[model samples]
Target: MRSNGGPVIRADIYVRISQDLTGEEQGVARQEESCRQLAADLGMEVRHVWTDNDLSATKKNVVRPDFEAMLASKPEAIICWHTDRLIRVTKDLEKVIELGVNVHAVMAGHLDLSTPAGRAVARTVTAWATYEGEQKAERQKLANQQAAQQGRPYTAGIRPFGYGDDHMTLIADEAAAIVEGAQMILAGESLTAVARKWDEAKLQSPRSKVTGAKGWTLRGVKKVLTSPRYAGMSTYYGEVIGEAQWPPILDPEVHYSVLAILNSPERFSGGKRTGRTPGTLLAGIGGCGYDGCTDTVNGRGYRGVPVYGCKDTHTRTPRSIADDRASKATLARLMFPDFLGQILETQNAQEGQSGAQLQSQAKELRERLDGLAMAYAEGAISLSQMTAGSQAIQKKLETIESELVSTAGIPPLDPVKGVAGLIEGWPTLPLPTRRAWVDFCCIVTLNPAKGRHLTSMSVDDHITIEWRDVSD
Candidate 1:
């Protein structure tokens, strides 16, 4: 039997709001209540209220999760506060109309968006909204450009290891920790160790709260070194902004120095050295003091001892050094007590240019570049000749410069420190230093006492020695 008032269709209610609406504490609630009241007035059966908060509503026919589910559930109709409320965007409104759901907005007239005029109104609203948002964004961009040109402090967001919100500004606490942390790393603290230091020091992340995140790691350290913010610079979408508002955590120079060290495999990838001679300075350096030879060693010496020798004895110069017993004896002799005096002499005689000198050489190369330019201007050189000549000079200069830089100088380990004062001071120095000594010092050879093997048994069992140097 039909009721006195007549049959009522169910109404599925949906609501959506963007991040901007987060400020409006009661917007969603009010929208929901008004729709419910409207549905009741129209004699509709109210079903579920579905909502998406903090979502953009400007898109035409946005496929909101709740809205789609309600449609699929085949509700009898959708009830809303107004027509624009039913569909902020055209596509969404068209979708419901196409699905044949009776959409009724209490304030606005009923719409069978199925017709051309109704569809036209929905599209016009969508287009207007999109245009408005775009124009707003453009205005904001222009304002920012004006601010930057005026040297005002700009900001964007606070990064895990960087600062600034609108522009070149840094949060003080985060900046301090990062700079101190870089120094700690430079001072020989492990990255893991540095992270712990921060935690122990009671510093917090830029988040203003500290309990949630893990401390620094190698990955974290790498990122901090690479960030330009600590060096008093800011970049936005690859555009450089100069003279930032926030104080720089690190002097740009010091920051770059740390960057160099971190990027250098020679500085960081050594892992840890082991044994009496902890480092293999010549580990990657090849022995080429001899003709047509390339050899290397464990820095491991005669027998179980540490010595650098010719790998070519086996591969390149077959049977170069022979007899195990004789080979061991030669190495032991080379480092004999008598060699102590020679070692002292070697240390005292060492001489080379400083990093500054190497830098000066680089300057010379730049001057050479200037010279070429001048020569070209004077018509003293052909274009092709100039190009080839400049390239060749550059290549050779780079090779020498690298060699000078790498082999700069190291005073051979002091023999006096070894025997007279205390223990094997060799253990005190880092392995990298030790490795460098054997790598660049004089050559050692286990050639036949007179270039002859004792017998055929000794032929395949020959021994070899290597030469390292110390120099500029």
Candidate 2:
């Protein structure tokens, strides 16, 4: 608006809304409309409109692009729905004050940044807003902790894969897919294979459904298999707190088995080999049997057939023959009453705690750690006290995890299925389990067959099976 009949003041409207869950920008639209009306009431000429939709002003490290643009424009006047919408902290207040513009707010009235008293008033208002924001954040954090302790499902963010929008109700089709995926992983199917099957079946991921994207990644499939929520567990900050209110999509036994396989150091190597799924039985397990060569073999094509060859070309054998030899040797060992009895004895001895008991212990340890952290946060305990308590709990957790790894790697065999049943079901066992059985029972090595063609090599003449000491 004109001052003393002078040229009309050029004004810019800045509007922002911290959250717009519907993505409709309705909140910002209302802010802009009120700001425009404020500008008109002051008889100012509107030159530009700046909007930062669904963007927090008080959150740390948040950037408001349109707010930055409005400041750069340096309009003669600025109008907003409220001072809090324009500036939530003293630092931001200083920025607006330095712009040297006539600031007007529909709710907060005029702010004269040009005067020292006006600048002080702006800083005071922003300080209160900052305090309110921090208090709100603390309340929300406490609410989340209480919800986790009560076994309430987290209802924010994207809906989980096997659950409905509320996160408590199960989605039948998605739940079935999750159950099948967990079974497949335990049966030796690779994460990539399961993801491909899901994509082929047109089973969309939660993220895919929201974004209209259509496929699942290997990582996504692994996430579903590893999530404790499917086992009816509630977690806070990645630590299991209690049983969830929702029905489980998978049995706890199945869930823990999948977790054990996915988190195995031998399989993942600190996640360095996450995407590499061995297609052959002994590609990585079997070593080169030739003297002076200690390299592992890898699967490759040889004369239009798959073969496992040493990296140093020390020895090569048909993949089929090597796999068959390893399978037969492993099966034969499992059929031996004394050998099978020894394996069962060792497994039973090592399994100190049942899966359910271990799970309960782990949950208790996690809760203890969480309690320590909260105590430290609330100043109820000294930092040293919290650290010592946390470290002690962590050590116990490590011991439990080590035991879990040992027990999880045990062969997934049914005790009801005797030795004869194992032999009958040997061919149908998942490749992963078969490979694990081979590694557990014996070491298969492809020795060089002197003067013999690759096709002419026999398991008896070239393959060596060295049985491991089960008692050890």
Candidate 3:
């Protein structure tokens, strides 16, 4: 196609549309069709078509893939559905000028790039587009704030575990499961156990619009159990700001009690198991099993005899006997003659089940928190909403990640593999490794025999070893 010129004018067509506030595309294809008709009427050859879907020109870092490619191709001219479709930024407009490309819009008409008057017109039109974009953004921000204050669903993202598709209404069964899980956690069940129960019951995990993960996770369970939203409260950045419109799954007192248990110092404090010297095997994993403490047991040499004791108290037990007791109990229950085979089988059976699921969910939740922060910064979410929401998510993420890191040191145990081959290489392993294995292998509860003094208690009955049973 040619005009009154010696050569044909070839123009690339560009189109873009951000997500509609009302959830429609608003005829972007029709705009493209109109642009093509304009190009034909002007006798300009259509060189290429560029498009960016669900992308906002107002966003500073949004990549318009085709737009960049068109500029690189250096077409004679560019045609777009509208002026804003081409650009709402002066930097992009300057790029078009440097490339010496004229631009036209179906709605705004011809842009002559060769002269100063035309350049002025292009800049003016782009500036208006930029301003309009900014105004719309501000309006959206205000709307988000209003939605948050009114306890309405605001973000068009993943539905939380107990919430329905609308995000405002609760799903009855899931909501009941959340409350039951929280009660279990508060009742002294491990997060992993609760998660296993959920998986066993075939409960659905929280669905992500982004990550698309649908596996039950210890991390996900904790998030549901600890979230203030489950208690019918709205949070901004971990701080509860107001009551939500949704019904509460758990009583406020029950929620706070669960929070207390989840946030306990013992749950997070890197115990003696964390920074032990190479030979200090049980230092961090030994908990003070007395009336006041369930923290990790501590190991020490008392009167030249290896002993395990509560670091914070006078409670103590002979370390050699405690280790032997724990080892035998674990072997009897979790890993017998075929220690390596049993543990490996247990681990293989749990692949993509608990540990992996929990880790992935923790990571996904952390990303969700980061997204909330970004939305807040961009003024798309209110300050209170971001703060409360981020705080809740961050707290849960931290707990999950901390648990993940803490568990990283403990390998699946294989008693038959010997001291140097078993998990944490037996007593010669790193402090953290030894601690983690001790925690994983057994629950040691120590107390003075009924009538004996603390120093005179018999090793047999003074301590109780409950070997961990990993069935799921």
Candidate 4:
């Protein structure tokens, strides 16, 4: 066919999406379908089509292959799903219009490019979208700011190792590791050396995987030392603030020292992967099972496997056979709990409010508790909050009804009295308190096999059995 007796060719359709238009949703497919339908309706021959998904609209000018090809081929017309779909910012759009590219939009009925009305519609739509994007960004900024102010992690990406999301915080395991790492780094171990130790010891990344395409990388170590998250603080768009929502990762001193290291010239500033095996978690924690034999390490494995053993067993072949058993027994006795008895004592203690005054103060406490619960349910709260709220509020009752019975005349665990206070002073409390006697208690973990040898037992882990720390 010929146009004005010169030449006529089919229109080539081009579709593009910078972000939020791929597998995330149907934006890409929808754009293509709409473009094809509009081209059919207009009776323009659909010559060829091209799609650029996740390709940024603001990328270098003239970098788009589809755009370059269409221009070079000089089709009779270039049709698009919408103006914004073709050109994001004004500069890019101007280049298209100047190149005689025709635009179309599926929505807005007839936002077209064949006339001035269409161009006006496109401009208004672009303006509104730009405004909406700005507003969303502003809201995110405010939300992140508030999170930081409350001592919560705010960064949306991977957690900077040794910290949680509520900003600068450290959980139990990470905190322990952090304490040790701080000591080592401060002792003048290179950052690269530290990283190597971590790798060798299977100190894996919480955010990333252990192997394959998503495996952990050395970047995790750098994050651990440089991030303020471990310090129980957060930053919003680079503005540091306090009161983080997550539990701190390291002691305050260690956290700040790490930050200082990051800023200082003498920081552990190397990533030495070559010629060195990474570290392990048990490096400093393991020793002989008995105090008398500290020479041989309680090896991590047995029969060529990782296992703890008496350091002096190889040298002092005639040592007492019961030493290992004795060591373990000591550790166990130190950690085990008489669950029911402990619970009874805890319930009887009137630590804070008395059982008699419990009703008077319960309303306010419950309200606060409810708010925390709601936030956690809505995903507005962090993991720490969710866990805390889930386990907190040991007990709640509307009215004291003259008393909450405890173990045989023990004071009631009241909304008023502290659990400890109630239990400690139980003998004098009202007899009705005896009715509140309860049997439930947490089971503590203890290693009966290894016993409590100072040289063999790991801190916290081996002593958790039947151990009652919090009574109320």
Best by TM-score: 2
Put down candidate 2 lDDT per residue, 1-472, tens digits, no spaces: 2657888888898899887656678998998888888777788888999999978898889999999988887888888999889999888888888887778999989999998988888888888889998999999889998898799987867789988889889888888888888888879988887888888778888777546666897778888888878999897766677888899999977887778777654463211132476777887788788888887787888678887878776777777788888888888888776887776566555553465578578778888999999999999999999999999887767556644554545554543365677689988866766777788788778887667886676677667888877774
**Which regions of candidate 4 are displaced past 4 Å?**
1-82, 108-111, 155-183, 197-220, 267-472
TM-score between candidate 2 and the true structure: 0.58
* lDDT pick, better of 2 and 3: 2
Candidate 4 residue 67 C-alpha distance from true site, Å: 6.0
Candidate maximizing lDDT: 2
- List CA RMSD, all candidates: 20.3, 17.8, 22.0, 24.5
For residue 33, what is the lDDT in candidate 1? 85
> Which is better, 1 or 2, measured by TM-score?
2
Off-target runs (Cα >4 Å) in candidate 2 are 1-3, 208-214, 269-472
lDDT of 2: 0.79
Q: How many clashes does each candidate structure show, in the order listed?
A: 25, 2, 20, 67
lDDT of prediction 1? 0.54
TM-score of 4: 0.43
Error in Å for residue 100 of model 3: 2.1
Sorting all predicted structures by lDDT, with the top scorer first, yields 2, 3, 1, 4
- Over the stretch 196-301, how does candidate 3's per-residue lDDT look in tens digits? 8887777766553334566666667777887778888875434345678877789976876677576543453323423424244445655556665666556667
lDDT tens readout by residue for model 4, 74-121: 666766777566666666555555555465555544444556776776
How far residue 249's Cα lies from its native spot in candidate 4, in Å, is: 2.0
* Tens-digit lDDT track of model 1 for 194-233: 7677778776554433234555545556666656556766
Candidate 1 TM-score over all chains jointly: 0.44
What's each prediction's TM-score? Answer: 0.44, 0.58, 0.49, 0.43
